[model samples]
Target: MASLCLTCVSEGTSLEEQVRRIKDIEAIESDSFVPQAFKSSRDDTKSAVVQVKQESEKGPSQDISLPMSIVYDDSGTLAHPSLFVDKETAEELWLNRLISLRQERLMGSPVT
Candidate 1:
């Protein structure tokens, strides 16, 4: 499992602090087994947010962001969070259908 932490610093902070935070985040991802931390972003509220995505072949291809219920192994509850479905559900469904079609095609072929 991979996780990311986003820390926000005050505007008055020295440049050294900001540089340190960026380096910290980079180091964490580089040292971790799986690099999943997204590029951090801050809104008008100065709140920095980091999102980690599950690695898969199908990359972000969703038209509309969907709400997800993250089921953690620790039995914690995370609800109604907007998430990006890389390749999206549409691509997933299409891939599944294609697999089934290939199977049917093979079945229809006569055995040698």
Candidate 2:
């Protein structure tokens, strides 16, 4: 599902490798001392630590090996969470959920 969105996104990007490419970027609106001197580094380290935790917890991403496809069914919405019609669209749908969970966990709720 998450693996199927790279073709239109980046040329020559095989579906199998789309998700493996991750770019971490952060934009801070403040040029203040706390952001540049302290909080920024703190947040970055925390993010790396969380990523490590995620890797250790999930172990292997073997599920990504499955062949992923997004068939465009002519539905009214064009994509449905329960339906696999649009794989890229479905990925967008699901990643938002993961982001929500991750953010919640970051706020100290702790999610698995």
Candidate 3:
């Protein structure tokens, strides 16, 4: 079994909203947060845990090779504070399928 562990980061008006967006993604198997689990060195931003599962023929697996922590920041914090995962880890776990799905979703709609 092979799974992909991702640290989805986002900046929004509400931390809960950002988390909700992550949860809304169909690919995410499960997610949770550890109270004050992360403190950003750049600012007062905080991070939490949100475990995502990728199902494969073998079964479910989580790529623990990288840190799995989701960071949430204020909406004005960054230009495009969107969810992200480690490139190396994604490649290792064959998580490109998820990315492709996301691209397909975005492509179906007109770009603003």
Candidate 4:
């Protein structure tokens, strides 16, 4: 399959040729990451395995792919857990559970 830059190819190749190239690309399953998109880099397979181990050992995993921030409020009468949700929803969920335990203790209740 002939690969062409979508942005500049339109200016050079005929529409029919562009369509044919696109069809060729569509016929093949592309890799998760393009080979030519970036320079050759070191493959950190060991680090990747370590990260997977660490994340798995921590417990349930999440699907968030962005950064997140959370802040806690400590002045509620009902002793509610302040769940600061952002990009990291799983972290927020875990924090909420921990904070709720603290809240229970502050309220003279048993921390479950």
TM-score of each: 0.20, 0.25, 0.17, 0.22
After superposition, candidate 3 runs with Cα above 4 Å error: 1-42, 63-112
Give candidate 1's whole-model lDDT: 0.56
Model 2 lDDT on a 0 to 1 scale: 0.51
For candidate 3, which ten residues in a row score worst on lDDT? 1-10
For all candidates in order, the CA lDDT equals 0.56, 0.51, 0.53, 0.60
Q: For residues 1-104, what per-residue lDDT tens digits would candidate 1 score against the true structure?
A: 22322344434656576677767777776746475668633222333344555555678643443334433344344643333445678688879888888887
lDDT of 2 by residue, 18-94 (tens): 54543111123234324434343322322211122123465753332322333344456755657755789878978
> Candidate 2, residue 53: CA error in Å?
58
Q: What is the TM-score (0 to 1) of candidate 3?
A: 0.17
For candidate 3, lDDT tens digit of each residue in 38-98? 6647563445445566567887775433335545555675555333556787575566676
Per-residue lDDT over 4-45 for candidate 4, one digit per residue giving the tens place of the 0 to 100 score: 667747578887878777876765555553445565334322
The prediction achieving the highest lDDT against the true structure is: 4
| Each model's backbone clash number | 1, 0, 1, 0
When sorted by lDDT, best at the front, the candidate numbers are 4, 1, 3, 2
Evaluated at residue 74, the lDDT of candidate 2 is 47
